[model samples]
Target: MINAESSAERTVAGPLRAAWGSRAEASALADVLLPPSTALPGFADPERWPPNALTRLASVLDLARSERGTPWPQPTASQYARFFRDGDGDRTDYETPVFDLDHRLTRAVLAALVSRDDDLLDEVADGVLLLCERSTWCWPAHEEHHRLRGAVVPDPDLPYLDLGAGVVAAQLAWLDHVLGDRLDVRWPGLRARVRREVRVRVLDPFTSRHDWHWLGLDGDVHNWCPWICGNVLVAALRLVDDPADRARIVADTVRAIDRYLAALPPDGSVDEGFEYWWNGACRALEALDLLEHATGGRLTAADVPVVRETVRFPRLMHLGGPWYVNLADARALPSGGQPWHVPQEWARRVGDRDVALHAAAQRSTAIPDTAELGRALRDLATPLPDHPAEPLVGSVWLPGTQVGLARATAGSTAGPTLVIKGGHNDENHNHNDVGSVIVAIDGVPVLVDAGRPTYTKQTFSADRYDIWTMQSSWHNVPEVRGTPQGTGRDHRARDVTVEDTADRFQVRLDLAPAYRVPALRSWWRTATLHRDRQRVTIEDSWDFADHGDSRSTLHYLLAGDVVRDGPGRLVVHPVSGARATLVAWNPSLASAALTVRELDDPLLRTVWGEKLTRLELRLPDPARGSLMIMVEVCA
Candidate 1:
């Protein structure tokens, strides 16, 4: 656990302000920050970037060049009004066009810079002008004006700076920095228009407003604090010509980031899980990197201890290729929407060799296909050091979030791995899955946490838990008295503990707090992974107000093809290259039934094919108040 006093004292913004708040510091920053054209990549000369940079980035350039004549899609008024028409709202209608414009402009800039193609300049200018002419940069789902004032369309006068807005603003800022001079020579006043549009849409709204919830001025902060602020920071530093204004904007960003840093647990675990780490923690690292560079190493990650502590989180959570411990609403197979360079660079900065190599392994030779131009540019300029791609494997215990992963082997994917979680039900993108466990054999999941489906109107609404995927019944936990676990922070695990020894690793949790069962008094679950035996055991002992708690059922969501061996045992055939696992339980105490859940959601299909199986064990007479289940790999 992090010391309370140390956490109180560790403030990123406090030290930053003390060192760089003055006009002198701002001037120093301005002097050190090279002009966009002269900065990293040096306006795309072969001497500036790595020899393989252009060739690696050619895929993106070629795609954009092929689509040069394609007109940018525009969201209709009806499409923008879909949110009010539906309860949850459709974000794709707004995001599809906005992000397409972002991608096109980013590609045009990269192509022009790399190939020095004059034809691409016109495409770049057209993309920028069209973006400026758009109704609003903010996604309909994120527009507060609609909820606050019942306005169907975005208020032109009120520019809401959201994730989309910040991204667009940064895109324009980077493009201008690199291609502004050339645009000035060919297309008069175009660069000025880009500056005007960005300042009005993102910068003015960002600095002038204190009420934006994402700023974290009043209360709780999440990924948005760092993700949005990081983008805005890039825009401010590059486009805001005045040193005083730039300093003030950067100062606000620093303080905002402090809230996010303060919220991080002692172990640097993201309760939101592995997928959001890219947007939340990685963005914070990028922000710090920018600060370090702009200040000439005056402010560094060394100032913040948590930065080093959290840098290895993604690496720690990895369970081989395309499989992560999908704890929350994150997909099992991440879309890789964000670039890998962010973590690679962060690992390099913090001297984490294992994490750096892991990040390098995920890195595509091509410039990452992301809307964030800043990320792509930095990735293009920096060459990844040669290292064998190997995932760190063994055992990891994140006490802050009460998550544990135990493997049968130290550094090889030759045996089964067991993962368990004991967090509250109200975690970010939460699933009611306290005291849930996942077992993977040879790096592929057998007993799985069935990750969430595609987002729709209800994903974030009051009816969020109504979705079956968000309920405890669909997870790998027991439903007490025919009732699943409840939602909220109060619905959480208690007395969680982890024990690690040379021969075994185990985790224990009092899971009664996670459910609201009238007859339930206590439910203690202990999951142990015996290393030499390559076996995992789950022992649940419970006492209830009523001794006959016969209604409770233990649920296990299984991936791969399942074959019933008998009433007490099931043989699981892994979907891919993983070995099969055998699940066994006490047949005298309970009876087993299998149900297939056909997955129709596009996102879920990507990870678990056409269907997954849910195995339910109904306790015939829970009067004994104890049950033991064993899962072992079948050679």
Candidate 2:
């Protein structure tokens, strides 16, 4: 519901205005900015590190040793032109090399630091030189020149400061800060090349340009604001020796970050879902940490109210290990691509032990492969706490985002859990699923959301909803009069309410507003989780203006192998090690049919395998009727 006008009004003097308001504060911050020598951690000199920091980096050193002779994947011009030439948006062809180059540099730099080996210095110099030789660091999808002009390839003179560019800048900056002196000993002018490339590609454009949409000046901010700012801030602090330039970059980045913080829901719910929280909210928190460090505690994340509230978002949306309330474009199983250490540190700063534990658990469980060298270095250097990791155990209701999660027991994923959302269709990475619900049993999704498919040209274009995964019929919601939920902010749930008690938790909302059916009056939907019975129930009571050949259908996308037991009853077998569940509906009101939807996208196949089953309850007559569905774990 936030537009440019409203966001602009709030950005004038938002929550972070007190942190760095006037020119005096800006000058004070500049006066105390960390010098280039100590801007980042002393990975170059590990003797001053914490006791176990070097030990933790042993794996990275080994990885560096293992890939010592492997050939780096080199990107070609054809790969870069694939998008502009044929409308292909798959970024793996060109991005794989970018990632490989960064990873190689990161591993070599850390390995040399850990083992004090001069042999690895040659590989490090190669990475730095290779980065400097690249035509563009920006990903092809983010390359605006293709859309702005008819150019097929990036212009060497104009660098697009997108996420990929920011990531490379930070990577080069960190490595230079850590190994610049060492490189000078052998590679000579390579350090200067890195400095020049970073200045041109990331720092110069970031500071000089005012029209970049991600800056949030025009109130169109999302995860990109904090993510790019955080990375750009790293490059600025580490590479920019000029105090005034550093200060201006820091101040401008802070204002943009403040705009992002102001735009967040007060309850700290991320409509982009759990995956983006690390990139969006956690990145801002990391930026705050950098500011606090540079200013000697003048600015702290603890001073921000939204930071404290937003740190627990991942925990709130968690549905056991690797399973979250996968709404919007977020997948059910997270890629863990972002840095977990950032959120872990944020949780510790905000004094939330549960969230801290959850983040640390994520760090421990997921495979660590990141192109952000700053976060990667920090992840290796930071030590995890000495406690077991657990999911957010109990029920939570975030009224700001209108999301409610209910579980049968506290601190244990023993039974059923119900997650319901009553948000608009125009949310970030929005899917036309205004009144969708997810049912999880012991942390495994039974009645599921299909998440998202691999990104293509159609993913973010005008034809976005044409993708079946982005449609309402694929979600656990009702389609009235053969019309699916509409898209946009106006098409959203109405009169949403949540009630959490000892024996039961319930969410009530009217979803009629989400549809565009002229014959529809109101579709009142109630989803309840009975903790005592350990069952989840979804009831849709809809009213129609006329009975004239109108019919509505309730679509429930179920994961795993689905078997129809008999009329009005179906059983879902376990998928991906989760337990099975029984889905039962009233036969008197509607007939049931199961349709198998085969997964073709490689991305979706990773989570749901080759296929997913959709169970539809068809209301033969849709004048005024109700449909009730109950899902319970089978004994």
Candidate 3:
């Protein structure tokens, strides 16, 4: 194991220090971020706070109070380990209880504080103590650590600082910070246990260890780094009393955040898709918000350009209507009622009204829970400006992941839009798609990506690629010599370039390297969007230096409804008058035969709410040849 003390020491003078600049800036940021140990702010009484300000807050508390009658679910070691031994079947049952408990305790405490319901104070006190005393507040995977080959996770008595566990502790700290005076009134030791558990699981372990994958100390960074660090900031700011100790934790958090930032491409494209972007980047923003609040204004996302760019990913990733271009293990289609506060709030921080407006246009008036009192409070403080949806301008090319976005007009959801992707198969949540594309007309999707299935043991195991939804065969790409694209960072597209204009959009990708076959020479696909023409033409050309009879099969995935129109044309019928006509080129190939296959995966069911259909184009395989597919949308 690495000497965590040394690692923590380096954090003070390392990349984070460089991001902060100078010893003075670092010291000042640490001061504002940790704030001298003091009493946490109390929850303002709803009666006198603001009119209807606590309405959503009250609703959250009411739901929790209602659920109080439901028995708290218990999780056992066997139930937790079932996934490791048997797969993903029973793990959710074990997990349901944890979420229920977390929600239960959170609601009880918020009700006691927000409504000042003295009747629920004892329940709040008991809830906090029970959570703090749970054998494991973390998920089965984190506590068991079965990911590594033949590795046995140490059975520690202390509550783990995993994402789930860390968030729970952070909430407990908030409870203690605001109502410690009240909680202390009941058990006295309850507040002390909150602090001790946080130290034992989060602070001490985080500052001293580099073993956590999310810490990014080993050079690999992803969503977890920012997610868990956010909770650390929550716990440390409200619970850790010692200034030096708090600074140490904050330094590690800053250092960890640097890892998440470092993982992002310079162009700010999230290859893991927008759903994970929300899960990760949004959480990071929350941490930054806390840091900004604690430190007055000396340090925050406003000081960093990359932070602004990173937070802008969600809006730019939109793939026309009803989708945000989610790829990989992310949901194939973005759900309705997406959260807008992160982008809206981040845009306001950076003073970018355009982005702020984009988020505002799509913002919903719904609120999920008051458990995240910090974010709720921030939401209340930063009132979003009402902004209407605008047409999307030109096109966006994220060179890092080779993901391209082109729309007919700026913010035109129901217009001609094309999202093309050509990156390696190994990403945060990878899928083996080298040359894949999606086509949407007037916000109606004609060609789509089979994003993912309900996660199970196979989803994250060595057999991950075995799942059809994760393979290139299931994507908008072709299979060469009956072999699909390989999975790994090394298995990526090469020689990718894009050209965009007011009326014409073209993306060219050299996908020869992604396949692992000696006989494979070169495979290239180009997607051209004629904006005014409302037409998209996808051309695939391939050749082998020394081969024949290659046998390549082209495929396309579609949602909603589709039907055969003619010899070389098929029409897709959506809910309204929005219809897309697909025309296959190369006369002979376009007229060849078309077959339909249904995907019965839950992921597809979740997105389409029904089984999605796949269209197959059986092109005559000459070993070395070309194929073309066209999709034209009519106004």
Candidate 4:
């Protein structure tokens, strides 16, 4: 994709500026750029701002000027070595501090722009150099993978670049744009080094590849495509002073963004769940916002219909509580609900006032990590509009993906809400469970998805299913014999049907193929939510032929505490105090017992903050038969 360009390229792209030159482009982007005398959000005094987002971030650099004058301890490679050896790349102590390097850099940039504090900028100079001088801004685990798993086994000895390369390059670019002059006069060598490093490391390598797994080279490139590319573009437009180089970067962006848009599901769904929906879409939006701002909307991708439709994904996927139909590594609830920046940005673009209010109300929740300074800059410049709440009612079924979301009502607090998933196990960050179901009474989630557990070496390896959370045995699905659902594209639901009406919603899925068990002849499940009765029914029909002797156990994963009155009946109490009675019965099965399983892990502790529980209903295997489970919300 990066070769010699012709005269046509020069004439057409015309300096990568869809409009060109900083003055006019900045003029066109008057609404978005930081206004004169504009103070950054939470920058006034910075003493009483929200402690977590900025104030606490400022604490890392001893910016709070609170008590101790100590700065954040710098990170080392040894800090990440053990985590890589343990196969947990993301959890190392190096993660947060390394991330804070950017956090501090962003703060410094904000200080330069809003407060014009030379004293604050002086304090942050060492931090930027600390990051820029590192061999790679990426984690050691990524470096480990690069060392071990290159296509030729360590043959490509080039610098290992992952998501961090783009992150650092982009941040540095913005840092330069906002205060390059100050840096030039005070620290010329450091300012020049930043540009030189971005070009030598990120730009040169990025434009060279068209299909690097992170680039939308093959199948659906996950968040990394836009997350990395978008930031790189921001870096290029901000730092690369040469018009030809900038034009080349823009050409690469056109190719990259086109692929990114192409890979998005037409229904605007992310199989990785809404947590990823926020990460992936929000990062992509960052790129889109930059493009519109830089090119004056001349080189915009928003006209792509799927691009516009993706705005609804966060709202559409938000089940009343922290609950989401989340598949993959995503929890049923998120660390923080979808960031307000997402909905706020999309609301104005999509002209949905309901979403605008949703974002405005949600903005104060948590600030984003990547483009925090950029988001803060925009918030101070063009804040979210005040809009009235609009009802969010509807059943959305994406036929292509076999995911169904049925809201109780747009705003109802007392009704049965059902979310069912029947997709293949090959999805990104997938769990082996295909025919999984989650039911909630009002906003209280009764049955749940055992989300993801603490990731280890086995988390991404061939032994992923060995972990309980990644298997069907721990999900709201049936385990045939001892065989839970298998992973990969082949083991998936078949002949799925979704029927939604004003009164009731039904989704039927065949789970026979999902199980690799030889004894499993056939399995079908029909999950119906009777809104009128506020009841949810999960009907399963199993045919085992002679293999009926194989023990069959089904599970109902619940978020809250569980109480069992009998083998056939159990009561689920979501933390919100809402309760639902689950009754399982079959004509052939004479005796059944409900057993519980629990897990304690660090990640689980943070996500759920309690012991995770799953009720396993053990039953006698009939020659062939059906089982019906009814969940009735107590009046």
Please report the candidate that would top lDDT against the real structure.
Answer: 2
Model 1, 537-605: lDDT tens per residue? 998887787665347889999988999887789999987788888999989887788999999988888
Please state the error at residue 194 of candidate 2 in Å: 1.5
* Candidate 1 lDDT: 0.80
* TM-score, every prediction: 0.93, 0.95, 0.90, 0.85
The candidate that achieves the highest TM-score relative to the unseen native structure: 2
The per-residue C-alpha lDDT of model 1 at residue 110 equals 86
How many clashing pairs per prediction, in order? 1, 0, 12, 1
Better by TM-score, candidate 4 or 3: 3
Better of 1 and 4 by TM-score: 1
Clashing pairs in 1: 88-457
lDDT of 3 by residue, 105-187 (tens): 76676677764556577777667767766766677666644554443333555445688877787787776765667666756
List residue ranges in candidate 3 displaced over 4 A. Answer: 1-16, 22-52, 88-90, 145-154, 158-160, 320-322, 335-339, 370-373, 384-387, 390-393, 575-583, 590-602
lDDT of each: 0.80, 0.82, 0.69, 0.65
List, residue by residue over 1-635, the lDDT tens digit for candidate 2: 32233445534766687555663245766787878778665656677665766666666777888877677667889888876676656667777777877887888877776665777888787777787899999988888787778798878797999998988888888888887888888888887788899999998888778778887766568999999998888888888888888888888788778889988988888888887787788888888888777766767758577778998888888888778888888888876556777778878777888888887877753225443667766776667566574856689998877888988987777779999999899888999998899998888888888989877767888999999999999999988878899998899999988888999999999998899987778899999999999999999998888896767889999889898888888888857666778999878878888899998888788888889999888886847878789999887
